[model samples]
Target: MSARLEAINITCRDHAASGARWAEILGLEPEGDITSANDFITYRIPGTEVYFAFQPPDNGEVGDTFVPRIHLDAVASGNTREQELENLLTRGMKLVVDARTADGAGWFTVEDVDGTQICVGRSDEERAAAKAAREGSS
Candidate 1:
């Protein structure tokens, strides 16, 4: 049997805030009503079947040392990678990693308001070119 991934569930202290942050970051809107603070909120990334759902933590206690096991990686669309990084920073996301190659193909990791790490990079073509250069050098 094969398992098909459909949605990603995120637990946060404030589901509404987290959902809003994700929506703004992805340029998506919440799927349903987000008025209720106790209710979970979901957002579907454009051009993707996957959904991201945010809910309050079950334990009701915010863990100061909790680190997410998985981080999300995204490719910049409709803008240059530098612009995308600037946009994210302007939105109060903390820059964790900033790396670039000679060809200017690189990625940056930013921590969102909810402390979720998201890595944004250039498009596929730039990635392919960087990979080819690396392989050729090797």
Candidate 2:
């Protein structure tokens, strides 16, 4: 057997709001709650089978309270690098890091509804190349 990155799950305070943000940023659509308990939600990548799941914060802390931390790195589509970061900022996302260099690096760190950290950043060329590959495959 082999282990693989199936999905990245984070805990959120508001399911609907977080899900909506993810949908807009990642250009994804949610089908339904990931589980019957209605605590987890999934957003599917357009041209891939991978998924990102957001759940509720963990309870039953015995000692130090754990702050939820997770991130879903999605391809930036049809948007400038700065535009992507700014869009999320307008939607209540706080910046963690910002850089636009020729080397195609840097990332923005933002917290979810539950204070969990997520880094969103990638170059336009990278995204466009991925889009082209996806289009070619499809």
Candidate 3:
């Protein structure tokens, strides 16, 4: 079958703005140049990598700013989503949404520096608790 995301792509009206914000917020360096108009500024989370493309925006308005709506989520891997959440929030990220499953597992939604929606999840503490519960049940 066809697989999961190789890289999630986001297009921003101002690549420089988004790239800079993400860099500061995520505490991750951009994988490459953040200057080229046609280039994608990248960020790698533990498991997934997100790339944001800087391009001219269509004439839409986000409360008077013509920014794009290319929202992307930087999901945490390796069971450290709680820590990841703390790290991101400490860097000025704002919680926008919180998602959960029928099994009570999922991610929290946060808005990035550019006002793009980002979904973050539980950290090591929650993961460990879940894992232990699973083991005890088994």
Best by TM-score: 1
TM-score of each: 0.44, 0.41, 0.40
Model 1 off-target regions past 4 Å? 63-138
Candidate 3 residue runs with Cα over 4 Å from true position:
1-68, 101-104, 121-138
Clashes of 2: 0
Backbone clash count for every predicted candidate, in the order shown: 0, 0, 6
Query: lDDT of all predictions, in order shown?
Result: 0.72, 0.62, 0.60
CA RMSD of all predictions: 11.6, 11.3, 10.6
Query: Which candidate number has the best lDDT?
Result: 1
lDDT of 1 by residue, 1-138 (tens): 111234566777777888898889888657777777575787887788667878776666678854333356677666667777788888899998887676777777889877777777786556677799899999
lDDT of 3 at 36: 62
Which is better, 2 or 3, measured by TM-score?
2
Indicate whether candidate 1 or candidate 2 has the larger lDDT.
1
Per-residue lDDT for 27-107 in model 3, tens only? 755666656645456655444444444444555333456645565545465546666667668878897776766664897
Better of 1 and 3 by TM-score: 1
Ranking by lDDT: 1, 2, 3
